[model samples]
Target: MLKLREKLLLNTALLALVLILQLAGLMKGINTKVDSLLPSPSPSLLSVLTAFGGDVFLIAFSLLTVLLDVRNSGKLSRETLVFLVSAVIGLVIVGVLKVAINEPRPRNHGGFSFPSGHTYRGAIIAVYASNRWKRATPLAVLFALGVAMTRLLLHVHWFGDVLFSLLLAPWVYSIVKATQDSWLPLYRRVISRLGLGAFDVE
Candidate 1:
């Protein structure tokens, strides 16, 4: 069973990546390419995501979450809840920044252009699956990266926006994981009282 602290430790590598990219003038070339990938909105598969905005992918990601949760280990219940909380925290962080910066979408739709919400949520679920299904690590990472690519292909977000998927989501997930861990005592107590710890996800 993966402990919450161990799960948080697993993300240290990703956090290092974020630290590097977040610095000004760091990875300029990669950043520019990321921004360039946000295509003009239209009927193209890529543009369609943008045309419809982010709602479509959000729903799709939710489905991914449910599927992964069902397939994951019982010990991951805390981590699973953490991932959900992180997704919301990421959304809220983006929303606050977007409104404060008043950074309109490329075509002025709405949303800050710094970090893409689609990428963040996609990354969280991807990490969730990868960690829980260790045998499928590469595939899980690829799936997450693919989601980031889709965001760029559809012009729903810029390259940097997609890049944030790997960059920021780890930190957000850690925050949620830590918060959840803080309440583990209560959870164990509740489980002990209900004797549900013996139950499994199926």
Candidate 2:
């Protein structure tokens, strides 16, 4: 498993690299170049596949995992809680950045689109699932990559946007892990106080 300190360092490096690329004026060129290579959108297959990363699908998927955990274990797992919290926090971060940066989409889709929300959520779910099931790392990664590709193909996001989402994923997981590890006792206490004792997963 990746440690918190390593994740912090990696996130810093990624942010620096994004800044450097943006400053060098290569970000737009890169997005344009990649966009040119993709074929016009086909609403059937690509639409179906891309929905795997959609808000409804991802949210339902997250809840389903939690429900499954409860069904099998009789209590919520800390890992599951962390995954849900991380995903929610990640969404908020993406939303804030999208509004703050106010970047536009590639095909004039008419909304702030610095970062791809689908790709971000996909990365979070992929990394979280991979962490839980080590053997599934390749599939998780491929799923995330496919989501990123679909965004680009649909002309909904810039390359840099999805790149940042992918780069930020592990770091988000790591931070959530570290925080939960340290504050778990408090978390348990709070859950107990709230009459949700079944959620107190060690």
Candidate 3:
């Protein structure tokens, strides 16, 4: 018994499934192009978006999400925590894998090339959209996809890097949601102990 809105959203999500699946082609030079024609994010735009610092946009967005929770009287949205935790988990997983595997980047790159951070961030943004604006999920996802494309076109990261993040976003989000559901009381306790009483919420 799905409402029209839910049905429409489900349909769109299905389409996203297809496209995201297809992006796997670029994950590890797996049927990928050494000379992909895809345009990268514009240099100026890259300068703007990638400026600040390590995951600057992410930090800003994460902080904003936290502030929004405060404004909402400490009632952190399940979606908000999911998005943040997913991104963080993705980062941590990448680090763990990098160290354990000692995986090298695509030669001459600054970091490992398995999963792309840009693509992962893009996917994370889409995860956040799912909780906040389900109807606009597709568009938000496209923007993230665009960021992945920019990374390749600009040659900052390799295909595998882009592919990894693309794959990681949704998975991390699910993990975050599951983890949050299982640990709400813990979250509540931590918040209570933080002396955020006025801003405390579930």
Which candidate tops TM-score? Answer: 2
Which candidate comes out best when scored by lDDT? 2
lDDT by residue for model 3 (126-171), tens: 6687568889888887777777766776666666566556666766
Pairs in clash, predicted candidate 1: 34-159, 46-153, 46-154
Q: Sort by lDDT, best first: what order?
A: 2, 3, 1
TM-score, cand. 1 vs. native: 0.61
**Mind giving the per-residue lDDT tens digits that candidate 1 earns over 2-106?**
777776666666655644564453645665566575554554665543322255665676666556655665433555556656777778876665465443344
Which of the two, 2 or 3, has more TM-score?
A: 2
Off by over 4 Å in 1: 1-43, 47-76, 107-110, 185-202
Q: After superposition, how far is residue 162 of candidate 3 from its true place, in Å?
A: 1.6
Candidate 2 TM-score over all chains jointly:
0.89
Ranked by lDDT, the better of candidates 1 and 2 is: 2
What's the TM-score of each model vs. the native? 0.61, 0.89, 0.72
Q: What would the per-residue lDDT of candidate 2 be over residues 44-98, giving only the tens digit for each residue?
A: 7877888888999888988788788878887887778888888888888888878
Collision count for each candidate, in order? 3, 0, 4
